[model samples]
Target chain A: MERKVVFAKPEALTDAPTHYCPGCTHGVVHRLIAEVIDKLGIREITIGIAPVGCAVLAYNYFNLDVAEAAHGRAPAMATGLKRVQPDKVVFTYQGDGDLAAIGTAEIVHAASRGENITTIFINNAVYGMTGGQMAPTTLPGQVTTSTPFGRDVKIAGYPLRVAELIATTSGAAYVVRRMVTKPATIASAKKAIKLAFQAQRAELGFSLVEILSSCPTNWGLNPREALEWVEENMAAYYPLGDYKVIDEVKSLK
Target chain B: MAKILMKGNEAIAEAAIRAGCQAYFGYPITPQTELLEYMSRRMVELGRVFLQAESELSAINMVYGAACAGARVMTSTSSPGFSLMQEGISYIVCSEVPAVVINVMRGGPGLGNIQPAQGDYFQMTKGGGHGDYNVIVLAPTTLQEAIDLTILAFDLADKYRSLVTIIADGMIGQIMEPVELPEIEPPQRPEQPWALTGAKGREKNIITSLYLGGLPLEKVNLRLQETLEEIKGNEVRYAEYMLEGAEIVVVAYGTAGRIAQTAIKEAREEGIPAGLFRPITMFPFPYDRLDEVAKGVEHLLVFELNAGQMLEDVHLATRDRLPIHFYGKMGGVVPSPAEVLAEIEKIASPQRGER
Candidate 1:
């Protein structure tokens, strides 16, 4: 009897094992992006700009032309690459601290300019690579190393709803928020990722997908509990939805 | 092309375009703003890339990206703006991508004034950005030299796969002079195997400044040092005027160098054996040549638009073999030729006798 293979790693991912801690969802998102690249048959024509976070070594995992950017400058770097090579698909992989805090200017301007690039923002509520610390997206009353007694709203402002902020930009064509806590949401996230890339391929303006991801090590929870926490706490604040879908992007097949 | 009267800033832009600079990203800053304005129109007309970035920080990173894609890229800024770009510049240098940067300097320790000054000497030549790296700095004295050096900047950047900076002041950036612009055909860029032009039919390339391990980072620093050593050996540039029988050598660069020429000529006619040593390359400074000049001359006078910034380099080069005199006007003051001549005369006078 002959058996058909149903599960295998995407070709877009290299054979190297990731350095992410156990239960971290960075691997899941990386695989999803690889799968999308494989489905689109664009691995050869894709360039990835990795941020200065846990995914700083993303170049090692993705089998594509990759460039590592200075902290919070990935969007600007992606714009540079895409402007010169419009035929190639360029994307940036950034974490919450990189996108929402230090790199806020770069991301905001990139969206305003309507630069034709895709961004995959991982909103994990804490700075992962440098150990757990309060990030721009850290929820109110959430405790991290820096916010030892839980974040105080009076001292630390409310968490930034990045997707909503990006949606308000006139130049943004597609902006969405999704979580990978369950298989259904994972599928929706992959769909959103594909649409963002599609928007770029169709010459639409900037597109971004903000993924509400998990950081078990930083959150001090098991991988299973982290998913439940994201489902219960993060999803409430950063509700999953299509925040911005311009007419041009919505019309894309 | 025939000699056309062009502002120094505009000529630098034209020369860069002629040299096949494919992309230009910059922000609006005084003095250097004209360069970005000129590119905004000309680059679009010529079907090249032009982007008015949000800030110098964004502009430098954009140039970094375009450069990583194997495109000839450039950016221009002033002192404070250049200060903001230090991080991106450090990353670009470590990544070893070819890029051109034009710094039309202004008075500054902190937003001092918009007038011309060379206070960035220590920053430009001594690695303004953090890390063990060096950028090739070219100081052009005249508009014609600005044009010529702007073109040379592209070639040198590409040749060394390093950042080449054109350090001018508001004097050179805002002044006007007739220049014969070179007509260069579009460059046929050699294939860069390391460039991140998608990995079509090849293994993917990674351009990064991050080396987590000690040995790997050390290797990167060692390699950068080796490249700098090569640049020092091959790219040191300076010019001498009336040094045939000179006893007193006035060392300057950019506007200071241009002004010193007049003073030297006036001193020459008055029987004072004064000559000018103008450095074209600020980095890989003419240390050896200055030492050679020291061997022939009795006194060395360093003049600049800043408070003796280059005097430190002059001191290092001469190694205290002879007395080094410094005359500088800080906070955007451009001393007249007569003022410099007076300084030269004071040094030349038998009464002020050999300090």
Candidate 2:
């Protein structure tokens, strides 16, 4: 008797092992992006820009042309790549510290210019590659290496809402925030990622999807508890929803 | 094309356009502002990529991206703006992508005034950013030379997959001179197997400067040093005037070199036997030729707009074999030809102990 294969790896992923920690959700998001690339059949013509965070080595896992940008310059790099090759689909995968802190100016300006590119922002509330430091998106009372005494809102300021801030830019055609705590939320996050790429394919404008990811090692929790932490702690503060969807992007589906 | 009177900054812009620069990114800065302004209008008309980035940091990173796509790209800025671009420049060089940068330099240690100065000589020639790498730096003495070198810079950058900088001063940027523009000829680029232009029918290409391990990083550094060696051997350029029977040779570059020409001519009129040796490639330094010239001349006089920045290179070239004299003006004060001639006279006079 012959048996049918139930599931397999995405065709867009290379046959290389990832360097992510055991409970890190970075692997989950990477797999989601690879699946989206496979679903759209754009692996041959898609280019990825990796930022200077844990995902800096993302180029090794994605089976497509990739360029590694400096700490916070991925958005600017993506703009250059897209402008020079208008037919190709270009995207940047950046972490919280890379996209929200040092690269704030670059992201804001890229969105303002209405550059036709996609960005997948990973907001894990801490700088993972640098060994758990207080990021711009760190929770008010969160503790990390830099904020060892628990974050003081008066000293470090509030956590930034990147999706809402980017949605305010007229150039951004689609901006959404989603988390992957459960199977249903994971499916929704994939849908948002697909939509962001679809918007770029249609040449509508800038599009972004900020994913509230889990950093189990930094958060000091097991993989199961980390998912629960994102559901109970991150979702309430972030408010998962679509922050910006232009009429053109809304009609994409 | 016919000889057209153009400002130095605008000529650099027009020259880059004719060289088939597919993309240009830059910000507004003194002296070099005209280059970006001219590119804004012409690149749009020519249907090329032209973006006025938020800062030099963004501009250079944009250029890096275009270069990684195998597109001929360039950026222009002044001293302060160039400082902001150092990190991007280091990354571009290490990634081995072809890109051009034009620094129409102005005075600076801080927000120093916007007057022509060569204070960036050390920065331009000897790896300004944090790394063990070198950039090909071309210094032009006149507007015409600036235009010619601007075109050559793009070709050299493509040939070596390296960064090429055109170092001009504020005087060169602001001056207007009649120059014969070259014909529009796109550079014949070599096969860029490493470009990030989609991996269709090929293996994925990755352009990155990151090498995590010591051995891997050392291998990258060795390859970079090998390329620098080849450039040093093949691209050392200089100009000599009346070195045959000269007792003194004036060493200079860019605006200072041009000023030295007038001073040398005055010294020759006074039977001082002074000639000029001007370097065209600042990084290559013309050490061999300068040393050969030192063998025959009695004195080597280094003239510059900064506080003897190139004097260090002169020292290394002659290695204390010949007496080296330096004359410099700081903080944007350009010395007149007469002033330089007086220094030449002092060296020539019979006050043997005055040295």
The interface root-mean-square deviations, each candidate in sequence, come to 0.5, 0.5
Q: Scoring each candidate complex against the real one, what DockQ results?
A: 0.91, 0.88
lDDT of 2 by residue, B18-131 (tens): 999999999999978999999999999999999999888899999999999999999999999999999999999999999999999998788998999999999999999999
Candidate 1 CAPRI assessment class: high
- Where is model 2 more than 4 Å wrong at Cα? A1-3, B350-355
Tens digit per residue, CA lDDT, model 1, B1-355: 5789999889999999999999999999988899999999999999999999988999999999999999999999999999999999999999999999999999988988999999999889999999988899999999999998999899889888999999999999999999999888878666699988888889999999999889999999999999999999999999999998899999999999999999999999999999999999999898999899889999999999988888999999999999899999999989999999989988889575444
TM-score of chain A of each: 0.98, 0.98
RMSD in Å for model 1 = 1.4
The backbone clash count of each candidate, in order, is: 0, 0
Candidate 1 per-residue lDDT, tens place, A37-120, comes to 999999999999999889999999999999999999999999899999999999999999999999999999999999999999
TM-score of each: 0.99, 0.98
